[model samples]
Target: MSDDAQTPTPMPTPNDCDLPRRRSDFATFAEAIDYAARSEKGLNFHDMRGTLERVYPYSEMRADAMKAARQFAAMGIAKGDRVALVAETGAEFAALFCGCIYAGAWPVPLPLPTGFGGKEGYIEQLSVQLDSSDPKILIYPAEIAEMAGAAAERQGCEGQSWEDFSERPDPETDLPEADPQDICYLQYSSGSTRFPTGVAVTHEALLHNLYGHASGVNLGENDRVVSWLPWYHDMGLVGCFLSPIANQASVDYIRTEHFARRPLAWLDLISRNQGNTLSYSPTFGYDICARRISSQSNVAERLDLSRWRTAGNGADMIRPDVMQNFVNAFAGAGFRASAFTPSYGLAEATLAVTVMPPGEGIRVELVEEERLSGRPRDLSRPARYRAIVNCGRPLPGMEVEIRGEDDNPRGDHQIGKVWCRGKSVMHSYFRNEEATDDCLVANADGEVWLDTGDMGYMADGYLFIVGRAKDMIIINGKNHWPQDIEWAVEQLPGFNHGDIAAFSVETDNGEEAPAVLVHCRVSEPEERIKLRNQIADKVRGVTGMNCVVELVPPRSLPRTSSGKLSRAKAKKLYLSGEIQPLDLAA
Candidate 1:
């Protein structure tokens, strides 16, 4: 009592109001509606010009969403029912998502088909996800209505475009209130590289993450965000779309296609609109800075980014040099190093896991490669090391632990599997309890933690991601499962014996497709050149994707400290831009 009484309790203030209500139960659709209504600014989507289009005010969006909910209810989608949404980003996508929530149906947003080998490959993937999700209804955009309808027909599900069903009457019936533990949505990771797995997030989980991110990142009604990341991605959906709405902020959204074609438009939009908070593709967007630096004289003097607060880096591996280059290029443009927040997150954690706190600058640790790859090391000795950016500490109410292969907790700076458990943790994989159980493991203390499948360790209370145990490759901020690419190349004649290594390289442009370094054991230079072209053509044909192929002498590929081929190390070599290319006839 003497010691306790000596310490004074801190007084709660306005910032404390930003803190979330700590609870186990999830907020229902009704709660979301109420929150939107209570927000002073209301809800609307802005274009590149910052022209606010009243897609729906807080009340109208909710009412429209509820009406859509009634339509879904008529289709037998009740509370806990699964509904799939496959559409581009627009007012309809948001409305359908909210409608599913209001109907007590869980929404699973699928990636629009792209980069597939062909239409057949696209159809195959679409069928696989549709079968896996087994939703009651498939909602799609009018433009892609025929393809979606055919896919749904093949899967024995009803499909309709928004235009077809938007005018349907709102069944004026009150649905059952969703419990906090109720599953909100199934976020599918980009299956660019492997079969996409759906992460089942609960309503409570999303609310907690949204609250932590909004407050921690200092986002509020005053902040305006302009985003081009597709809604299919966790960063785009959570960080750009939902977070803004949750924080009572305004958001400006441009189509991903438009941004991809006109990268400069992103900056132009930001400058023109005076958007304060935003995100971008690290590789593709790095070009924006380079183009500005080379072409636009006195860019820094011309633009004002002083109002920008959080420039989050995630969805792909963060490149140290890229960040440095961007900072140097834009130094005169009012962009500060302190604003670069290197972050780590996955689909399983409702988008954000660890965010480097704002104003911390970029905290990175340079660890010797030998020690990081599991070689026995002397920690006390000073040695040359590779630098890895820190993803900061866990958010309030969340706990993180690094565990070894034996499942026991690992000590500081020891690489192992990253595991986490919190209010934002997902409930289960939709319908597949076996798969869910494999991911969500129970520890001795009976706490269920999600296995992130990412390899990383903790040091001095901060988390550092090394690589993935699943062999996933992130190119240009897009996740491409390595096995998928390998499968595409393995069909070629000369690519056997694992002669092909597909991994990501952090180029100045952003993370491009894994540089396909092939070890074609041919001696003749001419034959090797021909093989290289054949392999490249095969990869493109099978995956309908473009990748840089480098033919090196046989046995040139590097291996991990554990005798396995190291993609991370190979990527390092590729970035140096010294890998000799075989002169192949185009």
Candidate 2:
């Protein structure tokens, strides 16, 4: 490449984004890379400003990975030895991840700093995850070398920069052979990270999920991707990056940090890129994008989402209202409402369990509020409906069902815990037998099922997730979902998603009561009191319970590495007084 081409640029190039799809199946990630290397298409990494930093095609990536694997081997990385990588959105991370596969080492992806907290906070998060993985070595980007070193030292690991690791001499060594049962990596999603559970995903588990992803998305023609999801997360690691590589389809990426700064650029890349793009994000991503574009003039003429065929929503509950607003805002730019594909999955099931059939879009079922609360629908009471989005059928080779408290399958339209069985189910949590046993169990059919720990109901083979089982709040012997309260508070003016966190807090009587921690920018005490009261009124109106509304400063509430609201952590912090409320009442 020319010197200018080697460096990143702000300009969008039409020629580099589209690459022909090659293979759709692989025995392992290594085999997929081996196959995809013959193709000209690969991943393009973007900078914090959404500028294209580097274009790494498959052939060159394979060469780099092979050499990196040799370096890893020279450094005494053996088969099944875990190599922890501080995953950033870049070529180095991609190369090291694949190099681990080639070296037969399990790559444990760790999160990068999102500035939610300062250096110490990031170090704590990194050290905790590193300790859980217990890797001998940690590889990290040079930019965060100091923080990575501190975290590595805490975990008794030797830390090295990605630049230093890449420059190591390549030893001409025989590659370690891996079997289908051999581990691919240790997947640590947000839920996993907060709880410190490392899901042991084998090669077989990963490939099965990818194949199902290909089949579920109908990946024969016009399947390209543009994503800002972080690689440490499953949807980003397996779905956007690995799935596209295995299928030999082209993908473009912006850093997760960058997406948080400029979410519109994520859509801008899609609008400017020349291909049928398939991208996935949580409801917040689309909401943020719409909010950004709404303020811009000439939005319709400037943005083009016509070719965005699969606009997927996952990693959290799908918000139909936010999606509808997005469609209404972007329809002038040819964005279709049918492009919304709401799906559900967790790290334990590898990645995708169910995907909406292509072109079927967001299908919602309006169930009565009484029936949802596990009570008979009384005609005497006025009917209130909760619109649960259909998350579609299970992928090929996957079985999904809703099971009651007795552990038996529930009938259609009955709300209960979600259970899924498939080849993609994780083998176990690495070295945590007790934890693994709690979730993975076998039935008379000899099929192992993963208890998703999510409450949902099935209708005509589609899954409708209500809320996380652990996150459900019980007040006065009635169950309430945190999302309902959070969404309710968001409906009030001056609030949106991420602005508030709703959970259960113990009262003076030691009974559970509703609590909401809201992010407030209002400085005057009167406005703050007014806002807090407004939030409490709305929440009480919806939940039928008095709520303690505490107005906190912006960015005070905690979030997962993937930017999902961490109600569990938020509650812990609040109860411990770590999250001090702004003095709105005063």
Query: How close to the true structure is residue 240 of candidate 2, measured as C-alpha lDDT?
Result: 90
lDDT tens per residue, model 1, 1-586? 7765654532211111233432212265357555654443333454544344444455556667777888887767788778888847777888788888878888888766553224664566567778988888888888777677878888888888888878766656777778878888887765211236677888788989887766556564346676777887787887776775566555566766666466555665566544465554543355345544666677866567676677777765565656787778777777788988877777778877887888885777876655555544545644535567788878776789999989889999998889988887777766777878888888788998988888789988899987677665644334454544554565676553345678765456664666688776777768877777787787665334677788776656654211235565566565665445555442
Worst 10 residues of 1 by lDDT: 9-18
Query: Residue 514 in candidate 1 has what lDDT?
Result: 60
* Cα TM-score per model: 0.76, 0.95
lDDT of 2 by residue, 1-586 (tens): 7665654453332333344554446677788888888766788887766677788987888888888889989988899999999888888888888999999999999988876678998999889888888887999999999999999998898999998887789979999888889999998867832267889999988989999888888776555789999899899998898888888787889988788887888988888777888999988899988888887667788889999989989998888999998997899989999998888898899899999999999989887776666655656647767889999889999999899999999998889999999899999988888888898989998888899899999888888988888888877778777887888788788877788888888889887889999999889999998888898899877777788889999989888866789999999999999899998656
Q: lDDT value for candidate 2?
A: 0.85
lDDT of 1 at 51: 47
Query: How well does model 1 score by local distance difference test?
Result: 0.67
**Once superposed on the true structure, which residue ranges of model 1 sit more than 4 Å away at CA?**
1-26, 40-56, 191-194, 273-275, 278-293, 376-384, 472-515, 518-586
TM for candidate 2 is 0.95
Candidate 2 residue pairs in backbone clash: none
